[model samples]
Target: MTSDQPAATRLSELLGWRKSPDPGLTWAQVEDRLATEVPRGVKDLSLCFPTGSFGGWIHFYNPVQSERALDMFLGRAKTKTENFKYARSLNHAEFPHRFHPEEGGLVAWGHGDQHTYFWSSQPGPESVLYCDDHGDGWGQYPGSVPEFLHALFMDELETEVLYGQWAGCRFFTEFPDYAG
Candidate 1:
């Protein structure tokens, strides 16, 4: 594995991805729905592969079907929406970040078995990721989607959330029902 390579490239090489991924997506629809700019690597991933999972875990929703392929990513935004909303309702300081639609709030991007990954427009550009692990609280990943996945796959990322077992599971499995 090339430690310093981009996640998309690394995954492609690892999986012997030879065909070019066709991008049949509309970015505006995604951005409008999420209320934020989609990270660059995410767009790249969608363009690089099919909708699938790495290590039989972690799913990323590529809402628009691509003629090519994309990998599975994660997040359950509505939960955090409720979490932050409830926190706000009770005037509780439980969540450090605000949920999306709250101006620079967090938006769910992917998820693992017990954790959810997120991105916040608050950080401006640099593209930082936030992971809320059900068992370990929250942690941050400073990069785009592929970067995070690549780092996690390489065990180069520091997180108290994503389990070590799942982190290095580099095997990619395409979703059976995926049409793309």
Candidate 2:
């Protein structure tokens, strides 16, 4: 056994994964066991770590699939018709809260000192939806829009789906000029 061998062995023991030549046990069997043992729910879901401008973020999806789930979790109507109906009801009822659809999503902005909240049903695959208290305002350090975006993307409550073709994702930070 080599140095790397010990690490692999240790990992296998920790995960109860062993590479035995026995016909009764296969890699696929191990994977199936792991999946079955793990419970499924919105709270248990997770998104891939973000890349590019959005990093260090997490996302989750709703456990149930229904109009109520869409409204409660994503904060958007289940369909365009439902969204229109909701909007119309708000308008006719003269409800204090106003609703609108933007970028193929439902949005509500006017609230007491609260940042505008936008929800899109068609977020790109791997993209998750979330609300940030900071709003779109950009500031230096953790208060910046980029940081907030990162936070929302990384939120544990966001749902993820594989959307859109991947071209490439990249991010870069510039350094201040230094003259000696």
**Each candidate structure's count of clashing pairs:** 15, 7
lDDT of 2 by residue, 22-121 (tens): 1222323422422211111111121111111111112211212222322332332223235444645755442222223333443321111222333322
Where's the lowest-lDDT run of ten residues in candidate 1? 66-75
Candidate 2 wrongly placed segments (more than 4 Å): 1-103, 106-119, 129-131, 136-180
Q: What would the TM-scores of all predictions be?
A: 0.76, 0.20
lDDT of 1 by residue, 1-180 (tens): 666866777766765565543445577756665567776777777666666666667766564554222222213566657765676566544466677778887777666566667777675664655544532366777777777776677678776665775445677666655554
Candidate 2 overall lDDT versus native: 0.26
- Candidate 1 regions off by >4 Å? 1-6, 15-21, 66-76, 87-93, 133-135, 166-168
lDDT of 1: 0.63
Instruction: Quote model 2's TM-score.
Output: 0.20
Most accurate candidate by TM-score? 1
For residue 127, what is the lDDT in candidate 2? 25
Candidate 2 residue pairs in backbone clash = 57-154, 58-154, 60-158, 60-159, 61-159, 125-162, 125-163
